[model samples]
Target: MDEDTPRLLADTNPLPETIDARLAQQLTFLIEIDRLKTVLRQSPLAAADRRENDAEHSWHLGLMVAILAEYADENVDIGHTIELVLIHDLVEIYAGDTPLYDAGKGLDQREREAAAAGTLFGLLPADQAARFRALWDEFEARQTPEARFAKAVDRLQPLLLNWMARGGTWRTPGVTADDIRARKAVIGDASAALWAAGQELIDEGERRGWSRPGSASIT
Candidate 1:
């Protein structure tokens, strides 16, 4: 090394291959996000217009958080919850969205979704893939408050659609209020206020002849 020259040092220990792998994984997420824009599915209510696909669902829920964060029972990181909601339904791309009431035809939806998650999220680079998989798992478990809030928003969307559609698509293939309530009661734990509003919608539906009254019963 020359005395008056600037010394050149090397980054001898560069970031490992995992760094590139993780970047690739994140790219896959971006690609999958774009791809989901094309796959449309019906809501639980079976609306004729065809419910928005997974990407739209995610975007809508993100907006929901922005609009409804004040309604959350406890302080929540809206950004994290929004991330959970956005990714939560991606498994449906491979497994298909199984309506809660029509679980009959599928080969065990839970098992199928688990498999789908493995493959879909696995497309990411290893580290990024693992991070997203954890997020997806957290959302599915509904254990943490953020996950619970995300799940509540998930259930709330369909109910609002059903109510607005004037008893529209929910009448499909023998779906009843019992089925809807059973599928959505987890929301009660997430946000009791939201769940109460849902119950009121159910009650109002029954009173207005929009849905079957007292159908939330187990009988």
Candidate 2:
């Protein structure tokens, strides 16, 4: 073994055997998640000058959940919903951000993200890792009310940002309004009010000529 390797391991020290390892595990996981700050997404910030990273995306989703929970079609546990949003993209810290418009790569993407989830969440103790993994899975599955709402906001955030930026990513060739609408359809199922807000943004984008006239029909 390298001389510094043992020293680095010693610094971690695994806490004390008698100490509750939960705190240490949780802290380790928290520190690992900070890597997300460096994982940039394809979507640009509202300013449209630069892209937003996964950490900012998760933070925005958390705030959206707080502000929009009341509009969910079904009652949701707000805390659980927040947890779902915050950790949903932690896998991206390893898998990297796949653009929403990317097609023909879903299977590979899922496999990559699953492996990422395993390694990243494994930083926590077994029990906490399982819980975190389950939350991420639930967000992907979108079966629970909380998960559905979280997914809706996840889709909504970028759409809103794109709208505010006058077609941040939408302006890119091959990104159609229909593509956006189809991707955002879940928001309609989750919250009519939020869906209405999203549609209004889309309409404004159309009116301002931010989106190509025929782009909506491309898909």
Top-scoring candidate (TM-score): 2
- Candidate 2 runs further than 4 Å off: 1-22, 104-107, 215-219
lDDT of 2 at 181: 78
List of clashing residue pairs for candidate 2: none
Cα distance off (Å), candidate 2, residue 158: 0.7
Q: Give a tens-digit lDDT track for model 1, residues 131-202.
A: 888999999887788888988888888778778776654566566666667777877877778999988886
Clashing pairs in 1: 25-124, 25-125, 45-169
Q: Estimate each model's TM-score.
A: 0.79, 0.86
lDDT per residue for candidate 2 within 52-147, as digits (tens), equals 999999999999999989999999999999999999898887788888777755548989888888887887889888999999999999999999
lDDT of each: 0.72, 0.82
**Top candidate (lDDT):** 2
Supply the global lDDT for candidate 1. 0.72
Report the lDDT of model 2 for residue 18.
72
Which portions of model 1 show Cα errors greater than 4 Å? 1-25, 44-48, 105-107, 214-219
